[model samples]
Target: MSAVMISRKVRKWEKLPGKNTFCCDGRVMMARQKGVFYLTLFLIIGTCALFFGFECPYLAVHLSAAIPVFAAVLFLFVMAMLLRTSFSDPGVLPRALPEEATFIEMEIEAANGNVPSGQRPPPRIRNIEINNQIVKLKYCYTCKIFRPPRASHCSICDNCVDRFDHHCPWVGNCVGKRNYRYFYLFTLSLSLLTIYIFTFDIVHVVMRSVEDGFLSALKETPGTVLEVLVCFFTLWSVVGLTGFHTYLISLNQTTNEDIKGSWSGKNRVQNPYSHKNIFKNCCEVLCGPAYPSVLDRRGLMHEDSPVSASSAAPSSSSSSLSFSNNSKPAPPTTKTTAPLIPNEHTPDDAKASIGVSAEQSCSPEDLPPSFIPPLASPETDAEASVAKDNSH
Candidate 1:
């Protein structure tokens, strides 16, 4: 029976639409293909080499000697930060433990009505108190565990990341808790580098124009114009990203939270992590006081007793039951002994019979009274009886 049940479940899972096997290697490959990581890298190197080595020398003969060296140093720093952000772990959650099994068992028991009515667990979807404020934590079905507040599942990475910021295509990685600092640094450095290059190109053009005639300088240093345009276009995006991140850091909010409207209005005050002081918030994100490792079932950061969805079985069961009641009808039953029934049924007659059977089988106390339809009136019953007699 158990084997059959397992096989049935496996078949059901296999039949589920849009269910695809998540391969880490495949995900990485996809990210590489979609992201502008290589394209951006090439642009950085090619533009710098062309502008600093060739164009700068032609435009500013005297200052050309120092330009290459400065450009090289800045480019290297930007690359370093980019690489660091890409390779660093984004704080993946650990696998389920044996203790979690117990929690699951408890929830099952509660759902099955083994537990007392008064002791029934609270609903899982309801908010939990964390640091004297109510917070709603979400469960990740893919991970088979609850995610911490600010944590999210990245579709590209196919993993739940702690303090998830965003999946940055430029970096070719998810900008999450562990790597956000490096990602920010990379953006800031890239913006500065672009501005520096833009300034150099502008200086070269201006200086050349002053020394030579305007048309002569433009005609001779065509590469300077290209460099200036490239720098100007790239700088807009890079600087804008840096500025946005700076604002996020000051507010102590992630891109996901900002976009999803999670920390708006009343929720802003309830968020325990935010200090409301801009300086303090920025320090927390950039300087790093470090978030707590441990969390309760509620997903609150603490060193208290470990709790999971299974740990608070009653609540989980109640939530599950509530969901089931809302979404579906009661289970069908089969018995060897057959009950007598009329051969024909009108639409209303069939509905009334089914409702009567459901009410008889499921008690009013066990399920909501709404599930059971009211009995047929005496007039209707008399009509049904008279029709039956007439047919006989």
Candidate 2:
């Protein structure tokens, strides 16, 4: 097996900056942080395993076969929807190109010309009319574009998602237009599965209690207690989630819109996306055509470095840039540099003399008479003066 192994190939999703973990060469994608998701998987698998392994056989033989059959089908559906919701793309929008970003920036600057110094700039928002309703689009600095209507940035995922809904930790994915249907189905099926398991576990225990006494029944089938506990706890959350999502589907609103009071507020803004008919809205939300993933996680990336994306974009008016000029290489300029020479005339007094030689002192008596002091040659001078007087 080691000798027959093949190296994994790098794909486009490997270079993506979004906060998602890609596995199996970009085929499986999920949130980067999925600690809760693992627990969710464990509980689901553990409870179902306990039910099928311990309680299902007894219930099928003694009670009814349809219980196990319906349970298995519901469990399979739940798991399928869970994986589909977790692994599928959540309608993530690609980041704007540097040129596009710069063009937008230039437009913003042009619109807001000559702003006073030391004043805060107004929020970057664009309002567009949708079905007679004004929808505000906010700028996403990270993605470098104004988000589309019903689209928003997920701080956890660090990606702008279309028809954005809240991120679900249990599913380990952001619930958005692409995967919300799967998520809704997952919650619905899971709730049904939990309720079924809980109901049967109690019934199985009661049957044992009737035949072998209640205490003895619990002792013989200890797994029933665990399964019951698991299902009982999970049942409420899944059911509540299912109902809440059902309401949202009917209204044709996202979790984000509902939370932000996009429709119900003091402003009394109506939902622009709604079809006005409850049946139509439900059908549109749950039965509409699924949108394709735009990120193209498995597609080959363009053979260009990421640094090249924004390097050539001008400071302003980037949309009007000439691609032909940008493609041409600029002429190179040559430069000459003179070598440095040390100064020879600089003073050498910076260094102290290690040792000094002693100077000789000459005595006055060793000098010639004319050069001598008068006191040293006093006697000789008197004798010469007497001889001169006799000659006169």
Candidate 3:
């Protein structure tokens, strides 16, 4: 008896094509990028201090120190979330080879008379119908498996991510199932921080301007003007991102799915994945389940669903059958029918039926018909034939 091996472990990122060496140096590169991100954060903080503290000393000294403290704390929280998002596993699917092998073994046993022939399993079916519409689960040829609904292959990361959001160039990672919460938190916190900074900078400018004339204050506090402008410009993008994510969380949809127009198709009003309760959706996204559940291709959540031969064998066969059916060409149509005009019709009647006048056949308008090639006259053909015979 052949032993069945099952790999419960999710596919590793480094094992993906063109990533063999990335595994060795990926951490180093990631660390470097993360350092760069941290440096950027510090630069923003330094800019805020330089403008707010040095340029507007009067406003800085008089204002409650607690404002800067609060902003610092918020910034740190955003940093933490950003780090989490960058490092967290993005819900990779397990490679199908092990499961596929087990299915093959079962089929072989049945064929060899080890199992009753009547009990032979149905072929594996990958495409399934949902809401009266046939929906094909996305199969990653690289991963060699059918990914769950809402999951997508990220070409950049070279991995299929579950509940795939979008790959953030800033974070230098794919924002997906395990890290989506962190990404959302980071966006929300960053938006709040920008808003706070913008407000604080505006207040500082106004307070200093009131003490001195507006032009003198502007000259004296150039840093404050810079900080205010920077924050004001950055505020809208951060706020918009936060708002968009908040809406997505409420609907239990991912950025990828929303952009792909997956939600509005047949499942528009009746999206099974969404709990339909905003509060529930938020809790599910933010807090997550106490026990992790495996999401099937249909997006159905299952806890401790044992992988038995009985269950696995049928799906494997079905998938193979589906592949075969899709690969095979459609049967040619055998039924031949007579033309609209019967062959027994006279040439004049045929011309009349075709709505073409004999006079128009040789007309200049029809001389250059795009589809028809020019034909040589009988005289030209006879001359060519006679010339060929004489040459012979």
Q: Model 1: runs farther than 4 Å from truth?
A: 1-35, 55-61, 64-66, 95-128, 265-269, 289-392
Ordered by lDDT, highest first, the candidates read: 2, 1, 3
Model 2, C-alpha of 202: deviation from truth (Å): 1.1
Ten residues in sequence with the least summed lDDT for candidate 2: 351-360
lDDT tens per residue, model 3, 331-385? 7989764434435445765757554543444466766557675699999999999
* Candidate 1 C-alpha lDDT tens digits along 41-68: 8878877876766565654567656776
Q: Each model's number of backbone clashes?
A: 4, 0, 7
lDDT of 1 at 194: 91
List the pairs of residues colliding in candidate 2: none
Candidate 2 per-residue lDDT over residues 92-150, each given as its tens digit: 99898889999999999988786899998888999999998888999999999999999
List the candidates' TM-scores in order. Answer: 0.59, 0.75, 0.57
Deviation from native of the Cα of residue 378 in model 1, angstroms: 99
Clash-forming residue pairs, model 1: 103-310, 103-311, 104-310, 121-314
Candidate 2 residue runs with Cα over 4 Å from true position? 1-10, 302-392
For model 2 the TM-score comes to 0.75
Instruction: Flag clash pairs in model 3.
Output: 123-317, 123-318, 124-317, 124-318, 124-319, 125-318, 125-319
Better of 2 and 3 by TM-score: 2
Among all candidates shown, the one with the greatest lDDT = 2
